[model samples]
Target: MLPELKDISNEEVKLPESSKVRLFIKREDRIHPFVSGNKYRKLKYNLIEAASLGFDTVLTFGGAYSNHIAAIASAGKLHHFKTIGVIRGDELRSKKDYNPTLKFAQAQGMKLHFISREVYKNKTAQTFLEELKRTFGSFYTVPEGGTNALAVKGCEEILKPEDSMFDYICCSVGTGGTLSGIINASKPHQHIFGFPALKGDFLSDIISKFAMKRNWELQTAYHFGGYAKINNELIEFMNRFKAENDIPLDPVYTGKMMFGIIDLIKKGYFPPQSNILAVHTGGLQGIEGMNLKLKKKNLPLII
Candidate 1:
């Protein structure tokens, strides 16, 4: 039998100074080492549907350090399904040993298929998918970042009956599946906030595709550049946040989100005395790979 998922808790974030509002982080990172946080939520139903559909092989796409790639590989291995990872950036094919995420996925028995950026951009094209089917044989397809109807269905489970007390719900947006789920599950009185890790105006449309309500807003200014881009200030904030809150945050997602929540609080972005619950969607597996880049750049690494 699979290990039973424990009750995920909300731990209060210790702000520097007491404010009118209280901030708590939903410890979704503790879900699993490889299949942690939103990745787990996003994949929960997709894997189930794959099994029900009689598929033994599952294929997905992601970049070098994607949490989704690592999580799916781990999940597939654990559940006895074959996994194929179509990794972006053909240049990374030779660097798997140095890339911790890729190395882990390989160790989990996922077959890594490297592709050029040009081809990856057209990954969803019918002809491209047909070519993949011809090359890899019949397999279940999970889109990059794992966003889909089933993914959103799983994410909707993130919020519980007890969580209705919170007036605000916050989560990091990648492909928008998790946020869409939260939006669907949220109480009418609660407001949902999405902090995008990537810089793009197109996310709104993606979210709209899955989201059923207009009770949420995207916090666009906190990306700190684009996806996978990080600076010293972000590194420092993540370190300090860990030191103070005793919570380790992934630089790409959770770290940026925590920074935004606090900054918004300080700027009076939320209504006074509003209760805020920030979802700590996990991507901690990518920290090791990010540190390698930080080392070469002579930058402070995420703690």
Candidate 2:
């Protein structure tokens, strides 16, 4: 049986009075300890489908500090399925002890297969996937970032009926699955805003394949240089946000989205009295790993 999902709450964000916009965060992070936020949603139906198909093992792809990898490991352990992670960096194999995310995943019983960056680039190619199939035997593949159709189906349930009152629905985009699910389930009048963690126009095209509505726009200005790249300014913002709100945000995703939302509000991107709801797709498990990188670079760490 699947673990019970917790009742998620929308916490109102206290914004500056001059901004003239009201913001709230849907705390999807509170849903589960390990499989939180979009990870939980994305894995929900995929696990069900895997079991129904009689697959005893689940295989997926991720980087050294990927939340998807950690979540899948936890989910597989909880659901009685063997898990395999095709990790992007081959160098990470010897450094597993220093990487909190990978260490945690290993603790959860995931078999880690570290691959070269060049080979990892072809992860989605048919030939490379066939190679993985031959090596790992029969297993249910969850794709990189866990963004399959069944995953999107689970993500669509993130918003509730009361969420329609918000004028803007915002989220951080990775593989575009979570945002696409939100777009498909959103009310017509609500405009969806996506803050991509990666630098690309490619996400717009990718999301289009799964989204039924055209009521969404991608805000590409605040990726903090690219996926998993962080600066002192971002670290300061994350620390201050946690100090004030008591909510910890992961540097890779939620922190970047919140930063963009605040910047947009200050620039009058939203009309006066507009209500905005930002989806907190959790990655807090990655904070420890990110802090290690920050410390190594002599940068201010995310508290």
Q: What's the lDDT for residue 158 in model 2?
A: 93
* TM-scores of all candidate predictions against the true structure: 0.98, 0.98
Lowest-sum lDDT 10-residue window in model 1:
1-10
Let me know the TM-score candidate 2 reaches against the reference structure.
0.98
List candidate 2 segments past 4 Å from native.
Answer: none
lDDT of each: 0.93, 0.93
lDDT string, candidate 2, 170-260, tens digits: 9999999999999999998999999999997999899999999999999999998999998989999999999988888989999999999
lDDT of 1 by residue, 199-292 (tens): 9889999999999999999999999999988998899999999998899999899989988999999998888889999998999999999999
Q: lDDT at 112 for candidate 1?
A: 98
Q: What is residue 188's positional error in candidate 1, in angstroms?
A: 0.9
**Local distance difference test, candidate 2:** 0.93
Cα error, residue 147 of model 1, in Å, equals 0.2
